[model samples]
Structures are given as C-alpha cells and as structure tokens.
Target: MYESGEVAIPLKDRVFGRYLADDVKTTEGKVIMKNGEYISHEEIETIEKENITSVRIKSPITCGCVNGICAKAYGRDLAKGEPVNTGEAVGIIAAQSIGEPGTQLTMRTFHVGGVASSSAEKSNFESPSDGKIKIQNLRSVVNQAGSEIIINRTTELEIYDLNKKLVSTFRAPYGSTLLVKDKAEVKLNDLLLEWDPYTVPIVAEEIWHFRF
Candidate 1:
C-alpha cells in the first residue's frame, strides 16, 4: 500500500549541485537547467531555518545515493533561489513490495539472522541466558526451514484469521489441478500438492501427515 507523508525542509542546510554536464547529451536535456544556476553548497550555511517549506513524501523507498545526497542536491537549488517546477520538488517514493515466494523466504531468513545475532551478543558462559539464546536460535532455524518442508509435503493448504479456524484448503491428487486466483493453474506432481490461503503450520510432525 502507498501512503503519503510530509517532510519538513531545513532552510539553513540547503546546498545544491548540478548533474554532470557530459551525462546530458540528449536533445530533450538541452532545455533543462544546468549546474551553478542556484545556490552553491557553501551558501547553505547562510539560510535561516524559517525559510523551509513542507515537502510531500509519496513513497518510502530507500535512497541508493550516499547520505541522501540526491535530495540534498535538489534542496540546495530550491534554497539558492531557483524557480520550482510542479513535479521537480516532489520526490518519487519508490516503494517495493515483496510478493514473490523467494523474496518472502529471504526476508524471513534475514529476520531470523537478526534474532540470532541479538541472542549471541548477550551470551555469557556462566549464565543460563546462553543456553536460552541457543534454544531460541535453533527454533528460528527450524521454523525457517520447516516452511519449505511443509510446502513440499502438502498437496493443499489454507490460512485462517486470528482465531484458530480453517479458512480454506486445497486438495491434491495425481494429475489434479489447482487454480490460483486470477494467476495461473498448476498441476499437482508426485512431489507435493498445491494449497490455498497459503498459511499452514510449519511443524515437522504435522507436515509428515500431509506427505503422500
């Protein structure tokens, strides 16, 4: 989901720089303003804080540039007395959604790593905390791998709400077909069956029950 927020501009620290002149070779770029037209980086120290305006935040994507220098570069131009274009001042919030199975798995693994690292950082030889941390780390590792094992063993699956209830389930037999909503139809193979709702418990014994 996309959300909008506001970012308060700091007037005192505005400094701008121009894009490399050699990079703008296209005819369309000829009309665009070049560097040195606005405030220089050194002039940022002179501006007062009250001169700032509210900037809109449309998306929450991570900036690849070092220390958000891209934003700072543009802010400097605004401060240095350049005319503003409608979209020119607005930042593109490139939100990324992790929808694919592989990406989801990777995120889960990353979360587990974080937990394991925290557990290790507090480890002490004499304290029982070390043993507890080891147990927690082991559990996270099993939980991560258990999902794949469940998917491999089960033909169908479903996810329920907060209450322990069955929302939906799919059944798989040899050559049986499963249709995902508006996506694709997949045929069941000997290895495993397809499922719905896609939120089944990742327990070894429970998964064993689904294995054919």
Candidate 2:
C-alpha cells in the first residue's frame, strides 16, 4: 500500500512489504520491493551487502490537481498514486564499465614475465669461425634469441628449442646451448659482443596462453 511520498528507510528498519525506493543496480537491477512486493530477510541482507543507504517507502498519494495542475501527465496512470516509475536500472552501464575494459585487457598485448626464448640457426653458407652463421632466414631464428657473437669458431651452429614438442621444428643445431637468459626484456639492438651473429630477441613469447 505504498502511496506517493519520498522517504528514506534505514537498513535495520527495513521489514516485509517495504519497497526499495531505489533500484539495486550492481550486476543486475534487483527490484527488492515494488509497489506491492513482499520484502524478505534475504533481500535485507542483500541491501546490507550492497551497502545501499536507505529504502524508499510508500506515502499517501495526495492529489494537487485542484488548482488545475495535473500532478501527472493526462494519459500517464500513476501506480499506487506515485508518478510514472522513476526507478532506473543502470546495471548494464555498470556491466559495460567493467566488462568492456576487462575485454580490452584480455585482447590487448601486455608484457609477461618469466619468458625465455629458443631458436635454431638459419641454414646458409656462412661459417661460425667467420663470426657469421649462415641462417636461411635471419628474421625467424634471429629474433627468437638475441643477436649472437660466435666465439666457438665451430662450423656447426648450436641452436636450442626452448619450447616443448608440438609439431613443427626448425632443425638448426638440435640440443645446442641456450644463449638467451630466463625472463629478459630488451629494446633496440644491444651489442653483447662485437661480432654477434644473431639478431636481438625483440619479439618474445612469454605468455603461453596467447601462443596457441
């Protein structure tokens, strides 16, 4: 029997039959108490958990049309004597505010830690003694591990695979020594040695989730 007055009800004072004057919009809009909705203890607990200030109770719908001023629009029917429903549900807005950014966070690229790189030497005519390993495609294995400086002077280039067995494997020098350290971040070409054969590992695969 809520009429048409705006009043605030304390959380503790809320009992059965009291309509939540405000729409409990968080995950979704929860209308705890409508014009004739029965309030339950669970609803009260929800209000407390959500930390809503107070509840809006119904008041007497006093008609002020005597002065030729219709309190409401001509065709608009008042519910329980109150104006057209003013309760608003903004749960969607709340959802998008958080959800949209969260989606971007997932799709967007981020630097992941604990990422080490592996590689196989590109096949070419260059020899290690000359400080140049002939890699068929320098861009492929070169970027995997940072640029290399060959001190081994061995014609056989040692390439290692840091990743596990999946399907494709570029056999440069299998079971070779690893050049890149665990969890490294590098920008622009850095000279580790004067005559490094490989290129800097600029693009790394740290997050395994994104690899597949």
Candidate 3:
C-alpha cells in the first residue's frame, strides 16, 4: 500500500510572489443548510475559534503564498474529495507541479566473461616450446569498386596437444594469400591441424583486410 503526504507546489513559475485569499474563497460565503443541519464555513470557523474541533482546510484556495500552504491545501482537498483513491490523485498532482511525469527509467545489467572470478590482466605468452616453420606461395588480390568483389584466399589452423587442449591459434596476414612458411615451428606446444581454404568472398579487401 502507498502512503500520503503534502503536495509540493511549484513557486518558480508563479507570476506573482503572493496569492490572494479572495482568489481561493468559495463562491458562497461559508454558510448553508445540509441534511436539516446548518452547514457553513462560519460555523466551522466558530468551532475552530472555540477550540471545539480541528479546522480542515480545503484546496484550490488562492490564498497568500500559494507556494507552500496553498499547495498542501490543494493536495489535502483532493485526497478528501476522493478518499477511495487519494493516493493516485495526490501522486498525479505532485508529479505535475513538483516533478516530471510519465518519464521512462532504464537500468542496465552486465555479465563478466573469461576464466577468472575477478578482472585479470591478459597474458602475452603463446606457447611452451620454440620451433621453426615456414609457409609458401601466398597471393592476395584486392577488388575495390562500387559493387561487391572478391580478392584474397586464406586458411584457418588450430593446433592442440594429445589431450585436446588448445595450444595456439593463427591467421595469415592480409595481402599475402599462401601458407605462412616462416611462421611454422614458432614454439607450438601441440599437434598441427589445418582447416579448408577460404576463397575470395567479398569486396573492399583493402579496407576490411585481416592483419594476422
């Protein structure tokens, strides 16, 4: 269940610093008959003066300094007028005068990746041993026109140990499109495996070429 509170009146936009009591006064001056009993603001004022009962202020009053007192009175008046759903009514009024209404609020959730429980620095080491290997006959063609074209050929290789643990990963440099001859035996700690060759696949090779 929600709670209730005094309404906050905005004073920044008020044209005049003060609000007149006459502006907030009812059309009929405080006296009337209701259910065979005399009902009037005068009677209530009299009771208030005599200290017989508490005086309840009504809202929409244009009394002096409407910023603080008048605003609270307006909220109270609304609450009393609609006691069954005063919470929503008061909220609407408060949002209109004191805060922004109907604005979307957003929140983001993030998830961490990798093996470490906390953030860790990346390692520069590649393999446990050192060896020498070489690739040969590499060629690359670049097609740069308004339409799509193909240029380079490449292959993917993944080397792993007998235990199936990934030892190293390598990609051929751009422009040169043959087996990397000098890149072999570069201290690869595991077995050698190669993937099928990739043919020229799209245009813009000069702009989107792979480096390693």
What are the candidates' C-alpha RMSDs? 21.6, 25.6, 29.2
lDDT of 3 by residue, 1-212 (tens): 10011112322212122222222223344432122222234444544454331122333553355344444333323335422232345445667764332332222333446664474332122444444433333344434433211133333234445455655444332322233333564444432322222332333435564688
Q: How many steric overlaps does candidate 1 have?
A: 3
The residue-by-residue lDDT of candidate 1 on 1-212, one tens digit each, is 10010112343332233222222122333422233234444433322222322122211242345543344234323344653443443443222333454576877753345653564221111211111111101111123333322223223333232343443333222122222221122222212222232233343433233455
Question: Considering lDDT, where higher is better, how would the candidates rank from best to worst?
Answer: 2, 3, 1
Candidate with best lDDT? 2
Pairs that collide, model 2: 4-59, 21-56, 122-135, 122-136, 147-198, 147-199, 148-196, 148-197, 148-198, 149-196
**What is candidate 1's CA lDDT for residue 134?**
11
The stretch of ten residues in a row with the least summed lDDT in candidate 2 is: 125-134
Q: Rank the candidates by TM-score, best first.
A: 2, 3, 1
TM-score per candidate: 0.16, 0.20, 0.19
**Tens digits of per-residue lDDT for model 2 on 53-117?**
55554422332344322322221122343233333223344476788668768989544445233
Best by TM-score: 2
Q: State candidate 2's TM-score.
A: 0.20
Clashes (backbone N, CA, C under 3 Å), per candidate, total 3, 10, 15
Pairs of residues at least 3 apart in sequence or in different chains that clash in candidate 1: 15-76, 155-193, 157-195
Better of 2 and 3 by lDDT: 2
Off by over 4 Å in 2: 1-9, 14-16, 27-35, 61-212
